[model samples]
Target: MNFNRKQYTEDDLLALYRGILLPRLIEERMLILLRQGRITKWFSGIGQEAISVGATLALNPDEYILPLHRNLGVFTGRNIPLDRLFAQFQGKTTGFTKGRDRSFHFGSKEHHIVGMISHLGPQLAVADGIALADLLDRKQKATLVFSGDGGASEGDFHEALNVAAVWGLPVIFMIENNGYGLSTPNSEQFKFASFIDKGPAYGIDTLQIDGNNVLEVYDTVRQAAASIRQNPRPILIEAMTFRMRGHEEASGTKYVPQELFEKWVKKDPVENFEKYLLDEMVLTSRSQVAIREELKSLIEEGLDKAFAVPMPEPNVAEELADMYRPFAPALITPTSPNTTEKRFVDAISDGLRQSLEHYPELVIMGQDIAEYGGVFKVTEGFVEQFGKQRIRNTPLCESAIVGIGLGMSVKEKKSVIEMQFADFVTSAFNQVVNNLAKSHYRWGQNADVVIRMPTGAGTAAGPFHSQSNEAWFFHTPGLKIVYPSSPYDAKGLLNAAIADPNPVLYFEHKLLYRSVASQIPDEYYTLEIGKAKLVTEGDDISIITYGMGVHWATRLLQTMPEVSADILDLRTLLPWDQEAVAQTVKKTGRVLILHEDTLTGGIGAEISAWISENCFNYLDGPVIRVASLDTAVPFSPPLEQQFLPVQRLQEKVAQLLKY
Candidate 1:
């Protein structure tokens, strides 16, 4: 984004510089502690100080901050107690991290700094999501996320940017481009374009700034943040900087050349800015020496106090979980919908209605989810019952939609995010892959959240609309994936997803929502994640599948009436029921695996691998497999029909029967 010349006052620069020095002093003291066997370990963001200090200066204390590992400057500058902060590094109970995560990964909710996330990309998307919530609630809080140059290259980075750009949510994406991306440089990360140059492709405004320039970095960030708040969309700021240290404390930084290290040391913001202050006569040599001494004293005082504080007694974790449980409406129960025959749409509608009724905090968001009744009417008439405050229909920005939901989840605890179509979910891929999947792993934070995607191929929607994306999330950690073949399981799993401590990526087979039915109870119920259902029992062979493929396998079983075939439908993808599958494989002695997802790297591959490793000895014959041809599910009715899993069913079944 273009900006007029803006500069900070001399005093403002000194204060920011002082903020930098305090964090460095703390980091250095912690290193000494680690070497002295006085602390477990510490990861200091030594060389990376300017952006952390400067970025904080750009936003107000009320504005939200999502910081990464090297965020001592930002956290300390924002007024997180130096002693409490250092205590956390020492693994004491009084430490900011509560002794849960490693040092340098805690958050101050009071300072409007959200909890620290261990994994990358999750916080970036959460920052975007929080900004969306503030906009919806008519508040003025904008969000900023600080990441290293390495995280920008991950798939989640692109996904988060795409969503932010499309929706124009008020969020800033700051990349601390410190030369190397953990051994890979910018050249290898993006061969097509520079990091900032690529932002426009996603309709985002981007800036490449000198990270070491305290004034330039602060002024540029302030401008970008202000612009985002006014216009509302994603902004990317690439701060060209260097790593004064290694990836982590244990990393000896052997990766950096001596020459580069020397060059960076000369340009260190602390030394250079101190010289600038002295040259301008803004502060005298006596004052500078005093400032240095102040830093040392401040650090020592912080450490002495932190070590004396108690560690979080074990019950802290349990207490946190208890706080998440709902009270009045202990579990979500359905409100009677007059409509009957149980269409998939009705099931989804009931689920929404019930969730809105039960949970005071439940939020529903998607494009055209309001008067338009959502693309498939799953959320039809929800806004009327729940009001716009609860059921939020948003602009068509899938990535941003998910990101916005993430932010809301952080602030409010639970939210339901519906991607218009499963295929369109690619628009918000970053929020799903990076943010949702990694949030808990990184920060010991939990998102009692629901992500609904209308997935699967059928009815000739073609390549764009007819797609199943569960396999993508299946590979990601910290995300629980649910794929239900029937209305009963769909509703059951959705309820469970909302109650889950971690984020749940729920895929609703677009075709099954209205067209399918099962004996769902009128009473409240919940299903456990990582549990597989044994649909049918047989002596001949076992058909292992989930979602639509379960129905297809059952259909194929009808053709082979002479052969007794058992079916195992895995409900959840991540942490799937390995023991059940191994048990089924042993019982049937023969197995045929299937899924509607594509063949290559599909969910089937995982099931197959699991069976190979654990169920291999029990197999009477080679584990037969059935899956859609490794091709983009074609849009044409006839071609799509041929392209799906039907063609492979007979072959796989025959092979399993023979075995």
Candidate 2:
């Protein structure tokens, strides 16, 4: 527990010295590699080795660590071989990612080291989710995420910190204040004096330390981390370091001032630490020199091995099609595990409960659901059963909620993030869309998290509240979106989302969350993800809709004469039912796509495009789209009704029948 143990062995001092020498030597070799044509461009972690090394030593090996690009010292401390790292720099077969991931692209499922993100600010949000999972699983572990002072300028950092603070997520937010971000300096990046001050704004305890002082950095961070373990909230430790190397191998260092360079070199982090160790008698000067030589030899050996490693054979069989799987049209067949008869929202609630029971690492936390049973009672009595540790209430900070959930999910955790109102999702778009959605594709790490948002326009929430933005995610890759219309579909798909390995955005229509009362059997059940359900068996036309729109479209179909509409509720939007849709369109000879979102691009356009391209032979009429009017929804009842799809449903039905 005590970081400064008053005395230490030669091995400990040598290890500390090695951490610095390795990162620094590697930084120089990176430049050599660039000049020697051994590698392409590179991003540097130079001049910031002090805190990374000290912080790594301070943390428990079992704890999760998510680092940004300039975290070489941390990686070295965690035992990532310098040769392997250099191989990544050279983009070779020996590269941990086999030429797929970028240099500094690092993750270890076994070591619990979460992937380092390329973007500066986004990873902070994911750190929260990872920590939440660790806590929910009752693991005696913590997570540390490193960011830069300049990264604080991003909205995601604020989002992540706020959520971690509000929900008491256990994690460390380390700011390596290296004065500059690429070409822009820290002062120009934000109005705040420092990143540490910003942490206090989010209710997180902040500590500013001399990042280059190994003992001081370790002592300060250790105390801060201990406090977080007890309170289980967020803590920000700003470590003042310098970026001695260029931002990357391609960067021109000519712009750096001569005076500043001289001053920084004189106060080199590695040399300074080495001198301190000698003064303190932790290691003699001879031993320090010997260790530095040893580090140089180690680096040389790794570099040689990396060069000697054979290139992987290229496979002509590996085509572009192997990159990803496109969504297909398929019916989500009911399975034995999801055989329970329950309403969609209830199924979601049960799925969450089941997930809690299934994965000890699963943690559920959000704005409210604890005692109030959620805004729609989707999580009624969950806190009583799971305890506050697993089910927690957060302040009204959507950014924080999602950010923290993201943090926990990336590490050894599975977080189920809940947004109280679907409309509130706009506040956390930075975290949800920019951070969680792209975490995996960008970093090659899986963020197994679920964001449950109660969506649609039916509850008369009016204007600011009612909107279907599924099109936003449907258009994006690396994110899975599921919108369920029925209790049965809801329960099954939600369970599937929970069990899936990727980040999933689960949209539960507010209208359907509690709309229908059905006899839900007390049994386990789940529907397959990315699949649709055929609610009706009419062959004249195919009505493709989801959430509340499916119910409304079905009602209109029942009321309209001669319109034997084959109703289809798309359970998942990202990997939607392309096969079932194609087959249904071919069979029915007509297709109509409906949703509660605005008519422009509201999932309907995609369906229409697919039908026109794939089912043109069977088309009797142009594909029609029934959705909320393009105008902003009105708060007034009459205007709202007119703007919504409910009022125009009959007219659309008549038109479809005529077609």
Candidate 3:
């Protein structure tokens, strides 16, 4: 039983013993609650407590920890109040997430812990971003991110590791390889001999250890933290262990072999550690018994108090209002009529410049954003002005980059993330739709992040590169979608999005970068996020459009002066100006919604549905929609032009005029 005692003192070993014991006791109580139907579900970490507790114990208290669903030991190690932990499982109003989230989908800003989302792998990239923020602030802190063997199969795992390695970010990617991913064993997951081997490919330091051994796990992580603080590089550690219980309470362990289960039970981390403490004389038999009884009593008291807390009030109206908090009307001072004109791209760059100047904590990250100034040159000269620390050039990892932005925003910093092309945003759809959009609603945590999506088609960029994917996010509730058609609106709205307290998807039309130009003010300004602009005044019909569609509709109206139509440019899509749309429709008595996105399931559908519901009586004719064909953008010049509804808009408007 002899071992090296130089790495940790007797007191440190006793603290580890207590940390491992607390989660084990809590989880056992959780299973009883589940059986009694007091809690809906339970995800046990009975046999894998050492990996979670040991690694967490090695870090500084203020350092961030993004735990996986099964890492109850992490909460214990971080000293998260047991009452709040139990209340969260009971779905009480006093829980960390205010009863909005159950299981591990909750975090504590005070404790510097990012709660786990059901999709655990995305947090790896978020941890990368957090570490990046620390590095920018010149803080010598590291972020510990956890994932299971199954979660490692996700693309986010690789993306996070790559970004962390390339930037030399201080992140520890810990893999709790617990033999199986639910019912599927590691043998079926990957052909690689060990998950640790994959780290070297990303230029990360790698280690594989006996996860069941608490002392070994703590010593390795302690050294890893020290090295990361000194050299600032990402490290991967694969902790070999087993999940003795089922994935969740309802998921029976029938798939596991009896022999395998028996083997792991004998190697139970908590029991094994207690025996080690006793053998090394670090803890007496009496002390071990006392520790167990203390945790049991604490768990019982915490659970009893948590269960007494009232359930959250079901306030649908309040939730809806809180979901999309209205941005204050921007006090836009009138500029001189002879203000200098700037291209759309220049205006966007100016907005970003103003944001960086306004918010000292703002960080801009994307592929080729730093030295290369981004592919579209939207961030040109940012690196020279702000330096690489603020203007980051990340690897080609769309999902992780967005996740990182989400993580950074959790620290009360603002992040403006650019997806090189809007179409590429689909790669990070899960993070956007699930993590970024849902963070605020689930936990009352605002992700003050702006995703600058360079969207739309016109340069014959083909299917993958050319897409107006705004419709994808239009259905998401907690996101603000803004698509500005002109230079003035672009600059104003970009500033507005950065200032908003929630995540905003700012879509910058790719074609308008050089094509559109207008006079804009030099001073800082912001526009209302959900407002619309009346581009042209007419009475016959209302042509509501945004982005490239605005130009198309304006051109069509100019061709037919005999048929007067009001062109209403909807600068924002998600929370479109319903009052303005109703007023315009009631005034004109006819309406036409236009966009570059596909006809089916596009933003047009929502607008059309709204007009039907609210402005039906005022409408003199049926609400019409003129949008791109229901197909991917074609590469050929002729096909691309035909695919979009630009030429067809003239004919559609002619038909609407007759109505």
Candidate 4:
């Protein structure tokens, strides 16, 4: 086949050939290592090298690329040192993630690469976030993200495409259709004949091509990136390809038919590209032999160096390090004389407004947060004050939005995302726990984002809208959970969460939006994140609670004038005030832990266990806990009221006082 060199020079074509050849040889070497037990696992990219190599070579060096497990060519095309990559595969400390993660499962910010999670489709949304950051900063950069045909069936895929189309972010969704997801064929994955048909449905430009052709991929991606730079928007490219080997080294290819392998072997990307280079006279037979031999030697040397490096010595300090950036939590004490009576919701709004002004680069995003002013109007006037760029509305894509926030944080941009309601956070559980919460610890990239969760059940919003789900995130180590009751603490805590160096879940009770009001300081202030407040001083017993539980304890105390008890509002649940809890436990010799969540596996359980373990001698009685029944929040107001811990708190407090 005669080649036309209109777009690329002979040198460029040879470079592309080298790129494809390098990964093919590397994967071949890795397979041999897998057999020899030198590496734990290997996701082979033998036949699909052209797609990763050509696509990566087509982009600007600064543009980000989120690669899949099979895109070893993406790393080589970016010129990542083979020695470091070998070390990463060998789990050495010199790797990108410092041996914290193995194989191709980790990202390198220095290389403008964000690695994919096993969930598959969240990286598409994270690419949109990087593109959005480039747009906001007026840097015309395009992001290339990869996924397989089976991964496109995920909800994150649909959400990412819709949001990227709506926002007109500069991103290229590269879908490699290898015909199977693990053992399942494409027939069982989706109903569409081609992913291109679904692109017009999302109003995104689409294209499809033979993924084995190296020059075609390079030319198409280069042109697509240029077009996106001229006018920023997302494009979907379906690369027709095949996986020639098993999903992983351990999983045999018994599921794949022999005829399918025969069909793809003839169309091998590396072999075909090399043939084209020879046909076009870009590579002579002698030169090709020399190149292959040189590459093999380089691979051997890299592997030897990687093998010589020592494995990581994991200690407690090393394990706990980089979970969060260093930032001292401070108590909120306003030096200004100006103070205003504000409702809980308004205090939160004021805090956001102040933060937008304080941090000019901060972005606030949520559903209906633009013109409609959010579901609860927390960002009512934000669009007018900060513009749509800073205060943005997103689609009903919980997972994508959270993943996007984490992606933006990867670029040093801080963000605040509102969940609308805390119950809906379940849709984004994986992104919160696996990606956003673990980003800092795994790769040393801090997810400096705050998620505002409007939680609690007093308004009768049903199971999907009203839920005190603080316990869900309290169990996550990399996250900071803060649930405030009063307006003063609400504003101060919100400020603290935004300024925090780690991912913070700020829970605002839905019932307290307008019902609770307090004298909030007019000046900007921040409260300590992991601190508790003593609302009342007493000696009979101690009540430890947060959010709506604080109000319940207060109401119970008002009703029973005879009982003198210490009311402690634990503003932060994860690092709940152990000192205050111990002091109160020793002072009263009896304690009660309260929350609106269910009794089992709730925050109250942790507090009770902690008191029992640390303050056993100080306790005159067993630590008592009052929480909601172990059932979904019922839609019936009567049932919900019965399910809540209001009456239970009254009964538990009296029992503890008597004890």
Best-performing candidate as measured by TM-score: 4
Each model's C-alpha lDDT? 0.75, 0.74, 0.88, 0.88
| TM-score of candidate 4 on Cα atoms, chains taken together | 0.98
Task: Give per-model TM-scores.
Answer: 0.71, 0.86, 0.96, 0.98
Which ranges in model 4 have alpha carbons more than 4 Å from their true place?
1-4, 329-333
Q: Which one is best on lDDT?
A: 4
lDDT of 2 by residue, 194-231 (tens): 77667657877888887777767766676767777776
TM-score (C-alpha) between model 2 and the true structure: 0.86
State how far residue 412 of model 2 sits from its true place (Å). 4.5
Candidate 1 segments exceeding 4 Å error: 1-20, 24-51, 54-63, 68-71, 79-125, 134-288, 298-339, 393-396, 518-524, 612-618
Judging by lDDT, tell me the better candidate of 1 and 4. Answer: 4
Q: Give the runs in model 2 whose Cα sits over 4 Å from its true position.
A: 1-5, 134-139, 159-170, 189-206, 219-235, 249-258, 275-293, 307-361, 410-412, 438-444, 646-659
Model 3 misses residue 647 by how many Å? 2.5
Backbone steric clashes in candidate 2, count: 28
Estimate the TM-score for candidate 1: 0.71
* Deviation in Å, model 4, residue 357 alpha carbon: 0.6
lDDT (tens digit, per residue) of candidate 4 on 221-288: 99999999989999999999998888986887999989999998999887877888788788999999
For model 3, residues 400-503, the per-residue Cα lDDT tens digits are 99998988887778999999998889899999999999887777667888999998887998999998889889999999999999999998999989988789
